[model samples]
Target: MFRDSLEAGARAVAAHFDHVLSDAADLPVLHAMRYATTGGKGLRGWLVLEGARLHDVAPERALWPACAIEAIHAYSLVHDDLPCMDDDDLRRGLPTVHRKWDEATAVLAGDALQALGFEMVADPRCHPDPLVRADLTLSLARAAGARGMVLGQALDMAAERADAPLDLQQITALQAGKTGALIAWSAEAGARLAHADLAPLTAYAERLGLAFQIADDILDVEGDAETVGKAVGKDAGRGKATFVSLLGLEGAKARATSLVTEACDALSPYGHRADALREAARFVISRRN
Candidate 1:
């Protein structure tokens, strides 16, 4: 059931991407946008849909922010893979946007996708209330802007050139901004849509977000490039600090496990109704990619 919901959510968002991009002008940037958005787990989008489901928001209404988060996420990946950034040549087993197209095209594609994300949430179709739309747009800006994901990315790049690697506390704070910000927003979006309390989902996402990064750190150490779908062991190669670096491999796994448990506990308010989210928490730490 969990797998089914996740795959369905992915398809729904992918279809939304096509529907929205279809109205855009026929340009290379649009093509790059579509390419960058495809072929992923769609975990962030799924979180939006599921949180909406838990709050009784219709899937149709929920899809706006679901797809929006995915667009923003795709944009981050495209920009992160650029020559000036991580300089990766591959993503999801295919050429990175910059590698497949040119750097200029990749930049335009990522920028357009980010704009499209805000546009979708602000659209009347997302919510009839102007306040709801405004809220979603504002939160997304904070999550994706200088205060959030961008801050994290900047810290990561700085760490690479720093005289000393980031300590565990610094790494934790950085991941909260970088990888965890969007996920937190995605998880709590349903509550925002319903105008309900954000505390529950926010707590769940904090632990879940940290666990997700830990899992990625684990995969970097244990996974192969072919299996992980991008370069693996690059963190270690760069002598970067990660959960795995600060904690032993077993200790990192243990910490991730503990986080998943706390994440599941945060959903207790919803009882068995949140089983899929619980499963998602477990899946985060267990996935190979």
Candidate 2:
């Protein structure tokens, strides 16, 4: 059911940025953005729909916002793969935008996609509440900007230097910003869009976000390139701070499991309405990539 919902939501906004480069007459960059955004499993969108499901809102009504989340996520990945960033060449089993095109085009495509995300969230089809739309914008901005993902990236890059070694707490803090913030925002934004009170949901997303990162770290350690679809051992090679670095492989996996348990417990208040979300928490730990 979740898979069907995710596919439908992804297709709904697949052409959302279709006119992105129409006036400029350069379709490839726009195509790159569309391609990157559409092909993912739509976990972020699923999270939004799942949150709405917890509030008994119709999944169809949540599709536009779900697509918006996916657009933002895709844009982040584009930039994250830049030479100055992760310098990755592949994503989702395809050449990255920068590698497929030129670095300049990739950068512009990422910028365009980010703008498209805000535009999609503001679209009337998503919802009627302007305040809620503004909140979505704010939530997305806070998650992507200096106080969140970018700042975390900065810290992560800086930590590579021998002068600064991240303690376990610091590693947690970094992942909370880099990985957890976006997940929390995705969940909270969905609940807010459904007009649900967000306190418990926010806390639930917080724990789940951290769990997601811990799982990612564990994957980086145990997963192979074929499974993860990116380079393995890159974290350790780059001296990046990871849960596995702070705690051995076994300990990191334990941390991920504990957080997944806490994430599931947090949703108990939502009862059966949160079944998809509960399953998603489990999926985070179980994912191969």
Best by lDDT: 1
- Against the true structure, candidate 2 reaches a TM-score of 0.92
Q: Where does candidate 2 stray beyond 4 Å?
A: 1-26
lDDT of 2 by residue, 1-289 (tens): 6557656655655544453334555578777877778667778777877777677776655666677777778888999999988899988878899998889988988898788778777877667888878888888888888998888877787787658679998888888888877788778866788677888778778888888888888888888988688778888887777888888888988888888888878877887777778778888888897
RMSD in angstroms, all models? 0.7, 2.3
Cα TM-score per model = 0.99, 0.92
Clashing pairs in 2: none
lDDT of 1 at 47: 99
* Top candidate when judged by TM-score against the true structure: 1
Model 1: residues with Cα > 4 Å off, grouped in runs: none
